[model samples]
Target chain A: MPTLEDDDLVFRFPQNCGRSTFRIAFQRTLRIPDSDREYPLPPGLGTFPLRHAEDFPALPDRMAARGGVVMPMWQAEALWINCSHAGRDDLPVAVKIAAGKINAVTGEAWRPGLHRDPQDYVVAPDQPWLDGFASAPGQIRQFVAMPLGDGYTAEEQITGQAEWGGLQISVTPMKRAAWDRLRKAWWPGLGERVAYLHDNFDRMSMGLGAGGLMRQRIEEDPHDLADWDQRATERVFVSLVHAAQWSALTGQQPPTAPPSAQAYAKAGLPWFQHYGCDRPALPGASPLRDLFSVAELHKAQTGQVLPGSQDIAAELPVRPFGTRPREVRSPGGW
Target chain B: MQRSAAPSFGTHVRALREARAVEDSRFSLRQVAARCGVTPAYLSRLERDESPPPGAEVLVKLAHELQEDPDVMLAMGGKISDDLRAAILARPRLFADLIRALRDTPEHAVLRILREVRDGDW
Candidate 1:
C-alpha cells in the first residue's frame, strides 16, 4: 500500500480532452553516504527512477525519512536540479516529489500515476519544451546515450551537455573585481564592434530592413536577409566614398557632399560653404549676422584666432552643450 | 463532426436575463438571492451553469426582484445549451512570443529589419 506520503515519483499524461493530467507514485530510495552529503547520478540515470513502479515502495527508509518527494511531471517542464543546497549546516533540506497527470484533451484535472515522456508520447512539436529549446541547448544525456535538439551540435551534446552539464551542479561563486575586469575588457570591445556594424552596415546600408523581412518570412523561408542587405548597403557606401576619393585626387566636385552642402547654404547655413566652396551672402534679417559678426566668421573659416572670437566664447558661459534641465520642478517641490 | 459553437458563460448569463425581461422587470438573480438572505456566490454558481437550477422559492424571489413572471427567468435559464464547455477550451493564447519579441525590440531597428525582410534580402 504505497500512499501519497510514500511516493517519490510522478507521471504526466494527456487526457482524452487534450489536457495534461498528473499522477503520483512511489519510487526507490537512494542510499546516501554519511560522509558525502550530496550524490551525483550519471546522465540519463536521473530520469530512471521515474520509469519503474516496483522500485518505488522498496526505496530506503532513510531517503523517505528525509522527506524525499518527487515533483509533479508538469512542474518538471523546465526542471533544473541544483545540488548546491544539500546537507548545508543551516538546516537539512529535503527533495520532495508531487505526483499527478494532466488531462490531455481538456488540459484539466490531475490523476494519480501515469506519466509519459516526450520520447514515448506524441505531442505537437510546438510544445513549450521545443519552443524554449530554440534559444537554449536542449539535450538529455545519460552515461551511455545522449539526445540533442536545436541549439545543439554533436560536439556540444558530448562536451557541454554530457561531460559538464550536471558534473558541476553547484552555484557559481562570484568575485566583483574579477567580473568587473572581464566586463570592462570584453563588453566594450564587443560593443564597439556592434556599434561599428550598426553604423556602417546596419544603419548606413539599411541592413535592418532585411532582418524584418526575414522574420516575416521565417516560417515560409529560411534565408539570411541581413547578409544580403549588408552587401547591398556596403556597395552603395563604397561607390559614394570611391567617387569622393577620386574627386579629391583629381580636384573635381565630390558629387555627394557638394550638392548637400550647397542645399544647406541655400537653406540658411551659409557657413556650410566652408566644406568645399566659397561662402554665400548672408540672408536679410538673419541671426547669422548678429551671431557670427564679420570677424567671427572670418576667424572660424580661416582657422585664425580673432580677438573677437575669444570674447564671444567667453560670453556664452562656456558650459558644454546639451546640459539643459530635463524638467523644471516647482519651487515648493511636490 | 464540426462542433457547434456555443456561447461563453458571460454571454449565456446575459441572454437568460434579457429573455426574462417581459415577465419580470426586476427579475435579476442578485435581487432574488438578497431577498432570500443567501450569498451571491450561490446564485452566481447557478447563473454560471456551475450548479443545478435554483428551487421554486428562490425563483419566485428572483422573479419579484426582476418584476417579471416567475416562470420566465426559470425557462430562460433552462434554455442554456450544454455545448458551451467546448467553446471555452478552443480559445488559443492568441499572441505568441514572436509578436512579443517584435514589440519589445527597438522601433528603429524593427523598421530597418522589416524593410530588409520585405525586400527578400535576409
Candidate 2:
C-alpha cells in the first residue's frame, strides 16, 4: 500500500492498486462546498472524460476554426501565475514550457528542494507520474500547480496523483468551517451572479483567513468580497518586495478567474471549463469567463525581474523554515 | 432466526491495524510484528487467518500498544472473560463507541483517558 502523511490528511490506496491501475488515493474524502450544501467528494481520481470542440462530425468544416477541446472538472479554479520580469535584458519571456528540474510553467530553475522540515513540501508535478487534461490551445498545462486548501480543486486532484513520498505541493483551506465563516461574512451573496465565482473560490481572493498574525496583516482591507479580492491581488504584488533572489522575483500566485474564452488566444493560458468565460451553448461550458480581464489588469503590472515565490511555508510552520526555500537566479545565473 | 458466526481474533487484529494506520502514517505490518515480538511471516499468517490466535501475553501487549482494552480484545480473540463479555454484550451501543474511540483517538491520549476511567469510580 502506498501511504504518505500530511498534517491532517492521510493518503493511502483504499483498495488494491495493481487491480485497478488508473485510480489515485486520497488522504481523506474531500469535502466539496457547493451552492446549496457541502457533500463528500464522489470517488473521483482519474482522467475526467473529455471531447473535442469544433469537431461535430456533422459540421466537419468548422474544424479549421480555433481548434479547442471540451472538458470539465467537478471543481477547479483555472489559475495562472504572471511572473514579474522587470530589468532582465537577457531573459526575454521568462515563462516557457519547463522540463526536468525546471518549473513547467514559469521555466524558473526548479530542482526539488531538499525537504528542510516537515513543512518543506515540494510539488514534484512529474514524479509518481500523472497525465491530466491540458488547458491551453497548443500549450499543454501539464501540472496545474495550485496551492492546496485554496478551496479550489487542482488539476492534480481531479486527474489523480500518488502520495507526496515527502514532496508536497502545499494546499491550504484552514478548515471547512472556517472557510464558510469567511464566505458568509464577506461575499455580496449575489446568488448565481458570483456563484460563478466558485462554491470553491481562489486562495488569493480569500486572504489568510483567521490566522493570528496572518489575519492581522490583511485586517485593514475591505471585508466585502469584491473589494477584498482586489486587495488580495495588490498584496500579492507587494509580496514581491520580500524576494531575496532574482528568480524569486517572477513568483506570482494563481490567477483568480477561470481562463477566458480568449485565454489561449490572448494570454497563452488555458481557461478552466467551469471558471472561465461562459460558453453556454457547449456541453461542458461554464459562465465564469473573467480571466481575460484579470490578465489584462495583471499585464499592466509586469516587470523585468522574475517574480518571487510566496513563502507559505514560513507562515504555517509557526517558525522559520528549518531549510530555507531554495532560490536560484535563473536557468543560467542572472 | 439464523445466528451468524462471529469474526475470528485475527480478523479483529486486521481491522484495528487498518484504523490505526489512519492516525499513525508510519504504522506498518512489519512494525506491528516487531512490537509483538513475532516475525513478519508469523504476523502475516495470523492476519491472513492461516494461524491460530496468539497467547494471552501477546494479545494483552497488542491491546496496550494499540491502546485497546486488554479484556475486550481477549474476549474477541475467543478467550471469553465471562464478566467482561456480559458487560460488553449488555451495552452494544457503548461497545460501538469504544471501538470508534479506539480507531479515532491517538494511542497515548486514549490510554490516559482509559487509565482515568479505570482509576476513578466513573
Candidate 3:
C-alpha cells in the first residue's frame, strides 16, 4: 500500500496485480450554470484513471513499507501547450466553448457559412495506442476522451488550443522501475498479451482480457457511436503534435486572441493540487491526514457518497511517462 | 443487429398505430398490447420504434388487434420474413423486381405483389 496524500488528494498503489491509483477527495467541476456541459480538467481534477482489478487481499502488502516514492501522474485525454502569450500566473483566465474556435458562446460559427468540423479537431497516428480507441481510423473520441476544451492531431487538431495558449497535453509512460511496479502489480500473468489487459477509462472501461476470449469473438458487434460515453477507450495511447500537421486536421484558423486571462480563471480552470508532491518517503504529514480531509467533508446528500465514496484517491506519483513529454517540441523535434 | 438510422423498418409503426386508433376509437395502446399478450410499455416502445418488433407470433397478434396485415406490420417493424427474403435473394431478376416494388410501391401493395408472386404461376 504505497501511499501519498496532500490536503484532499491521495494516491495509492496496491500489491497484487493492480495499477497505481491517483484520485482526489474533492473534485472541482466547471458548469456554465444552467447548461449540462462539463469540461475535464486541463488538468481536470482527475484524468480518467487507468484501473485494474485483482484480489489484492490475497497478497501481502510488502510494497506498503517500501516508503512512498516520487512518481508522475498520467491524466487521461489531456495534453500540454507551451505558449509565451499566456497570461501571468495571476493572469485572468476565461473559458469559451465552441465547435471549432469560433464563439460558440455567440453562435457565430468559426467559418460563418463553412460547415464546422466535428469537435473541431483531429488526431495523429504516431501514437499507436489510440488505434483501439479512435472513433475512426485516425480520429479520437470527441466528448468522451477530449479534454474540457482542446482539440487533437494534425496541425488542425489543435487549431483552437492556441486560444487558451495550451495545446493538447500528451504524457509518456512512467519510468521503467515505476511502470514495472504498476505493470507487474496490475497484469502479472499476461506477458506480451499485457497490452490487451492494460487499464483504461477508469474502471468503467472494458478490456479484452477482462471479458476473456468470448468477447473478442464478438468484438465487431455494431456499436452506436452516439453512445460513446457508454463505452470505454484504450489508455496506453500517447497523442503527439506536429504544429504544421496538427493544424491540417481542421478548417478554421486557430483563434487569434486566446481566452483573456480573466475568462480562463472564470472558466474555473483546475489547479493540480498534487502536481509535485512532498516526499512520499515520509509517512506524510499527520496521523490520519490522508483520510482526515475526507472525514471532514459533509456527506452532502445520500447519493453523492453512495455507491461508495467517489472521493477515494489512487496512490501514483508524478513522473515522466516517456522522455518526449519532458521536453515540449514539435513532432520530429523530439 | 445494426441499429438503423432514419425511417427504419419500425418507422411507420407509430403512424400506423395512430391511424388504427383513429379509425376505431376503441383501439387503445393498452388494449392492443393486451391482445398481443405484452405490457403496454413494451408495446408502446415497439410502436414508437424505440424497440425492435417481437417474434412472428407477437407481430401476428398485434397486427390482428389493429386489423392490419401481419407481413406489413413485420416489414414496418423492420422485420423481413426469412423464407421470402431468401427466395427473392436466390434469383437475380426476381430480386430486382422485389427491390423495385419495395422502393416504388406502398407496403400493402408490395406485400400483395410478393404473395401473388410466391403463390401464383411462374
Q: Which regions of candidate 1 fall more than 4 Å away from where they truly are? A: A1-59, A65-141, A144-168, A191-334, B1-122
Deviating ranges (above 4 Å) for candidate 2: A1-334, B1-3, B80-122
Whole-model alpha-carbon lDDT for candidate 1:
0.23
lDDT of 2 by residue, B11-70 (tens): 878887877776665458889888888887988888888998888778887776565667
For model 1, residues A214-304, the per-residue Cα lDDT tens digits are 0000011011122111111110000001222333333434222112212222333211000111222111111111111222223444676
TM-score of 3: 0.20
List TM-scores for all candidates, in order.
Answer: 0.13, 0.20, 0.20
What's chain A's TM-score in each predicted model?
Answer: 0.15, 0.18, 0.17
Interface DockQ of each model = 0.02, 0.02, 0.00
lDDT measured at residue A76 in model 1 versus the true structure, 0 to 100: 10
Cα RMSD to native, each candidate?
A: 32.4, 25.8, 27.0
Give lDDT tens digits, candidate 2, residues A1-334: 1111111111111121111111122111111111121111111122222223232332122221212221222122221211211110111110111211222222223233222111111121111111111222211221222222332122112212211100112111122233345546545551001111232322221110000001000001112222111111100000001112212222333112222122222322211111112221111101111111111212333532112111121211112211211121111111
The CA lDDT of each predicted structure is 0.23, 0.28, 0.28
Off by over 4 Å in 3: A1-334, B1-11, B23-25, B89-122
A45-107, model 3: which lDDT tens digit per residue?
Answer: 222211111112211122111111111111122222111111111111111122222222122
True contacts kept of each: 0.00, 0.00, 0.00
